[model samples]
Target: MIIGIDLGTTNSLVSVWRDGQVELIPNALGDMLTPSVVGLDADGAVLVGLAARERLITHPQLTAAVFKRYMGSDRKTLLGSQAFRPEELSALVLKSLKADAERYLGEPVEEAVITVPAYFSDAQRKATKIAGQLAGLKVERLVNEPTAAALAYGLHQSEPESRFLVFDLGGGTFDISILELFEGVMEVRASAGDNFLGGEDFSEALIDGFIAAVGKQHGLTDKTADPAVYQNLRKQAEQAKRALTGAPTATMTVLHAGEPLSWTLSDGDFLKLCEPLLKRLREPIEKALRDSRLKAIDLDQVVLAGGATRKPLVRKLVAKLFGRMPAMNLNPDEVVARGAAVMAGLKARDVALSEVVMTDVCPYSLGIEVSEQLGPGRFQPGFYLPIIERNSVVPISREQIVSTIVDNQPALHVSIFQGESRLVKDNIFLGELILPVPPRPAGQISVAVRFTYDVNGLLEAEMTVAETGEKHRLLIEDNPGVLSPEQIEERLAALAKLKIHPRELLPNATLLARADRLYQQLLGEQRQWLAQETARFQAVLESQDEALILPARTELKQFLDEIEGDGWL
Candidate 1:
């Protein structure tokens, strides 16, 4: 069986198309949402979802979160005793979701359709597919998150024709996609975003505000040396942020190094604090609108997706910018998963989705970087000439002509990149290829570099030598990582050796980790108190009092959360 997976930044979910409708598959906790976190327990077993997230607060040095932001990069996250690439961490999450889907369906799932941000680069998208492969699933399609949301929304709505803008601001990334829906067709016109901007950044803005205020009042330095203290304050501020979503006022309180610091922020004040982030959101929206050749009034609907869009300020900003309220009838968080399921159904050629056809655009420009001569011997090395522009419909082929730079040049180097910068140094280098050219004078031997992009986001670069009808095609592998295929295999073997606890023990393990973390964060009396609670919980867990364990775990966790003044989940 094949399932649709919304492997998100903050939380991930899986769904399946059954009975002509989409249904979400719940995890072991019986919740559809799984926290995108991974870590190791004291026993050296892998822990994921809530359990891992809880450890992130307690054992900040031993857990990893928000690795999704590093997708396609050479960056690695260090856990307690191992280092993992972002794709590997993502694979763990995908494995957890796959387990849930299998258990729910009572069947094996070998394939899936995953969703990514519309503006995700080719490298990032390919990294996602690799992550799926690591999780033991074949990933054939990657739908844009915003486009998936539109599918979920438009498929159910009564409207026969509509042009909408999808504003998706999730935990760690933002994407704005403009799409048109007409006669059972959903065509994505354009996409744009800043990968670093999202709800977590907003939370950081609040944390920064608190830290600045505390530093000024205490006459201390601007930065804290302790990461634990920073993470603790960040957690509290995040909870307070959620509280402030609908409420007018909220306070963030944390006890740090024997000092109790508290700050109350009003909606107006919070907005002021997030002025920079709010300003950043406008760029992608404007870019999407401009690329779609759309005016504010031309949009038939403004569909808001992602959990971050639930904020009142976000809604107000959209309303003010578009002169209309964005649709709120559907749950923003679940919209992408639902739409992904619809896509999965379409991929499977299910009769219900036979009429639905979708198309997507390239989110960035693709071109070759070459040296350009100014007048005489003066040459610039980073000139970029685009063969395919950004926001152009994909499954497309575009070509641009380039000539030999010197007389009787036998070989020419073709360096392909993806970006809008006029300087090639500023763009993302995809790969380099060498083409053999027949000896000819400068600007005489014309070579046409053809770039063909398919729905999978993979690129095929081909160079046709006009003089001899000689052609060379190279498939650029999207792995910009440090590992080769052999090294990845070795890494995979090593990773597979790690142990993972049974799913049923996740909640107990999570509470224990939380209590242990609290013990570490507090000092003196508070530490002793947390240690005692930890012992009590440990006793209850050892006793195997199945009925009593949950209540005790909940009570202990609630007590610690109450003491810390954090209600964030």
Candidate 2:
């Protein structure tokens, strides 16, 4: 039997299609959403979900979470004596979800439909597939989270003509989507988002505010210098932010340098700290709406997903902008999982499904890097050739035919990119394709570069030499820097044999101390400015009764950014 999984940044959930109904499989905590955290134990065993997150307060260095944000990058997370790729870390979470599904079904689960962000790059999507493989599940298909949410919402609506927008603000990523429902088909007209922004940013905002308050109270001017204290304060501030979302005020108490310090934070103060982060969300929302050529008023209903969307301010903003109250009937945390389960059932042939064809658009433009002629003879640096514009429908393919400029050129090279930037260097390079051509006149040798985007939004670049008919195809799996199946097995085997430090004595204390010292230095008008912003942030933070440590933390981090640039003191 197949199950659906929503592998989110802050939380993970599993669902299954059973008895003609969709049901979410709860974790051991009896909660639908499982924290996407993993920690190393003293005996070298791996712990996931809430158990792992509980260790973050004291074992921050040994725990790794939110690695989903770095899915396609070369960023290596050091958990102790062993290092883990983002995919590998994600696989652990997937494995846990698989276990939950198996336990609920009373059988072994083999296949799943995992949901990803609409704007996830091809590399990131491929990496997510690999993680599923490592977790011992066959990834039948990768669906966009917003698309899944739409399927869940549309299943209940009998409206013949319906149009709505989906605003997903999860723990670590945000996406805005405009979808149309017609003739039993839910089509995504356009989608856009900032993969790096989400509820996590809000939590950081609160952390920075608490750090600043601590600095002023103790007269310690150089709070920013202490990483360890700052880390601890950030943790505490995140807790306080979550508390404020439900209560009128939250008290934060921490012992720094052997002295007990306490601060009272009103809900108003929490929202003020997060106002800046809130502003960044507006651009993506506006872009998605504009790209679909639909005004805010055009949307009949707006659906909000991700745990972070529970923030009262986010809902208020959507209502004020769209002139309609957003729908929250479906579980914000479980909607994607439920939708994924329905998709999994469809794929498994277990349900009598409708054609319900879904057409999605590419979030970013695809192009090739090419050198352009500056004037008569001089050539400027290479720039990108945008073959597939952003928001173009798929599964689609486009061809860009060009000829070799040099005489008797034996081979043609094509460099691919995914971004809206006109400059090649500004776009992300998705690897290259080289095809051999017959030795012919420079201008006569033509090469056809075909770019095909599959239903999963992954790109396949194939080049054919028109004269010779020689061809070459490249898949992201061919890249070793990004792990393939064999590489994942090898790394998993090696990880099993490696020795790692115990969670009790990781360098989290030192990092937290450094973070604290750095947090104390901003004072005078700097503190006043942040305080005013925090007041505005609290107005939003206090309005929500849901648990929101993640968003508050993000807000605090933004406040810290106002005082210091990337250059950490």
Which structure among the candidates has the greatest lDDT?
Answer: 1
lDDT of 2 by residue, 1-569 (tens): 88999999988899987877799998654568777888776566777776566555455667787899998776888887768889888988898788777877899998999999988988899888888988888999898998888878878777877998988999899888899999977889889998989888887776667668875668544534554455556556666755766788887666567676778988788778877877888998898888899988788889988888877777777788778899998988888888898888778776456456667888889988876777765666578888888888888899998887666888777878889888988888788877777788767988788888888878888888787787888764554347766777897676556443333322222222223333343446765766665555456456653346336535655655555442211
Scored against the true structure, residue 76 in model 2 reaches a CA lDDT of 89
lDDT of 1 by residue, 1-569 (tens): 77999998889999999989999999987778898988888887888898888776677777788889999898978887688899999999999999899889999999999999877887888788888888889996998899899899888778899999989988888999999999999999999998899888888888888878774575434434666676677777778788898699988766665677788889988899988999999999999888899998999899989988988889999999999999987888899999999989999989988889999988899999988789895667788999999999988999988888888998989999989999998999888888988787788899889999988787899999888889999777744763556766876787688788788888788677777767765678878888888888889889898888888887897888787654355
TM-score of every prediction relative to native: 0.94, 0.84
Q: Which stretches of candidate 1 lie over 4 Å from their true place?
A: 219-224, 376-379, 517-534, 545-567
Question: Measured by C-alpha RMSD in angstroms, how accurate is candidate 1?
Answer: 2.3
- Error (Å) of candidate 2 at residue 216 is 6.1
Look at candidate 2 and tell me the lDDT of residue 111: 92
Every model: Cα RMSD to truth: 2.3, 10.6
